[model samples]
Target chain A: MSELGFLFAGYAVVWVALGGYIIAVGRRQSTLRREIARLEREFRTGE
Target chain B: MTTVSPGSTAQPDATAAVADGGAGGGVTTAAAAPLPEPGRTLWLDILGVVAILSVLVALYGAIIWAPTEAVMGHVQRIFYFHMPSAWVALGPAFTIVFICSIVYLVKKDLRYDRIAGASAELGVLFTTITLLTGPLWAKPIWGAYWTWDPRLTTTLVLWFIYVAYLMLRSSITEGHSRARLSAVFGIVGWIDVPIVFMSIRWWRTIHPTLVTGEGMNLDSSMEAVLMLSLAAITLLYVYLLIVRVRQLDMGSRLDRLRQLSHLR
Candidate 1:
C-alpha cells in the first residue's frame, strides 16, 4: 500500500475501534436499564 | 459490600421491595445500591459533546494544519493519533488501573474495583489502537509490518498482560472474590507499563523515541498538533472511563437487587 493508503487505513482503524466500543457500551447500557426497570416494576407489583 | 442474605430487615423506604415473600424478602437498601446522580448525567452529556468536538478539531489539525514531514511524508500524520493512543493507554488508562487496584486492596471497596475494571477495559482498547496503528505506520516506513524490537515486543506483552487482566476478571463469579483477585492481578500487571515505556531507551531499537532527556524531535507545528491530539484523546478516555464505570456500578447494583428480588 502507498503511504497515503496506510494513513487512511490507520485512521480508519482508530475510528472503527472507537465507534464499535461506544456502540457496544450503549447497547449493554440499554439492556441493563431495561432489565433493571423490569425488575423494579416486578418488585413494585409484588408490593 | 451489598451481600444478600435471607431474613434481614428491609428498609421501609427501599427503592424496590416485594411485600408478600416474607416481610423483608426482595428488599434492598438504597445504601447498598446507590444510583448515579441525575446531575452527573447532564455533566456527562456536556463532556461527551466537548470530547467529540475536541477530537474533530484534533483530526483537522493533524491532517490539514500540521506540516508534512520531509522524511516520512504524509504518513507521519499517523503519529499524531498513534502516539496519543499509546500515551493514554500507558500513561493514564493503565495508571488508573494500578492506582485503583491498590486502593481497592487497601479499602476493600468494590467501587474502586469497578473503576479498575473499567479502566482496564479502556486501557486495552487504546492499546489495541496503538498496536494496530503502529504496525500500519511501520509497514510503509520500516519495510515490514512488525519487528522483534524491544519497544514493540514489550508493548505487545503489555497489551497481553492487561488483556489477561480482563479475562481474569470475567472468569470469576463472586463479587468480592473477583475484585480481590483481579485487584492483585491489576497491580502486578502494571509492572509491564514502565518496561514498555523504557524499552526503547534501554535497548537499541528502530522505533523512534519522540521524547528524551533533551526534548522532543518534532518542529513547533508538529508539536502543537501532537499536543492537541494528546489532549483530545485523553479527554475522550476520561469521558469513556466515567461512562463505563458508571455502567459497571449500575450493573453491580442490579446484580445485588436481582439477588434480593430473587430474579433469575
Candidate 2:
C-alpha cells in the first residue's frame, strides 16, 4: 500500500475498534437491562 | 432507594432476598420489589462529553496542526494515534488490572475484580488497535506487515497474556474462586508489561525507540500533538472503565437475584 493508504488504514482501524467496542458495550447494557426487567416481572407476578 | 456509585462494591439490596423471606411463597409475597437499575449520574454525563471533545481536538491536531515528516510524509501521522493507543493499553489499562488484582487479593472484594476484568478488556482492545496500526504503518515503511522483532513479539505476547487472563475469568462459575485465581494470573501477567516496554532497548530490533534517557525524539509540534492524543485516549479509557464497572456491578446483582429465585 501507498503511504496515504497506510495512513488512512491506521486511522480507520482505530475508529472501527473504538466504535465497535462502544456499540458492543451499549448493546450488552441493553440486554442486561431487559433481562433484569423480565426477571423482575416474573417475580412480581409470582410466575 | 439504594443508589449505586459506579465503581463501588456496596451490595444493592435484592428483592429476591426479600421475597425469599417468606420461605415457600416464591414471589407470592407483596414486599418484593424490582431492584433499582444502576442509573447514570451527572458526572458520567460530563465525562462522556469531555472525552468526545478531547478526542475531536486530538484528531484535528494530529491531521492538521502537526507538520508532516520529511521522511515518512503523511504516514507518520499515524504515530499520534498509534503511540497513544499503545500507551493506554500498556500504561493505564493493564496497570489498573495489576493494581486492582492486588487489591482484590488483599481485600477479597469482588468489586476490585470487576474493575480488573473491565480494564483488561479495554487493555486487549487498545492492544489490538496498536497491533493493527503498527502493521499498517510498518507495511509502507518497513516493507513488511510483521516481523519477529523483540518489541513487536513482546507486545504480541503481552496481548495474549491478558486475553488468557480474561478467558480464565470467564471459565470459572463461582465469584470468589474466580477472583482469587484470576488475581494471581493478573499479577503474574503484569511482569510482561515492563518487558514489552524495554524490549527495543534490551534487544536488536527494527522498531523505532521514540523515547530515550533524555526525552522523546519527536519534534516540538509533533510532541504537542502526541501529548494531546495521550490525554484524549486516557480520558476515553477512564470514562469507559467507569461505565463498564457499573454494568458489571449490576450484572452481579442480577446474578444474585437469579440464584435466590432459583432457591425458591
Per-candidate TM vs. native?
A: 0.82, 0.81
lDDT of 1 by residue, B1-264 (tens): 356563353355443433333344344433245556322567789999999999999999999999888777888899999999989998889999999999988999999999999999999999999999988988887687887666667779899999999999999977788999998988877975676657644675554643221333589998999999999999999999999998988887776676576533
> Which lDDT value does model 2 have at B80?
91
Model 2: which residue pairs collide?
none
Candidate 1 CAPRI grade: acceptable
DockQ of each: 0.48, 0.49
Q: What is the TM-score of chain B in candidate 1?
A: 0.79
lDDT of 1 by residue, A1-47 (tens): 88999999999999999999999999998888766655655575555
- Model 2 lDDT per residue over A7-32, tens place: 99999999999999999999999988
lDDT of each: 0.81, 0.82
Q: What is candidate 1's local distance difference test score?
A: 0.81
**What is the two-chain DockQ of model 1?**
0.48
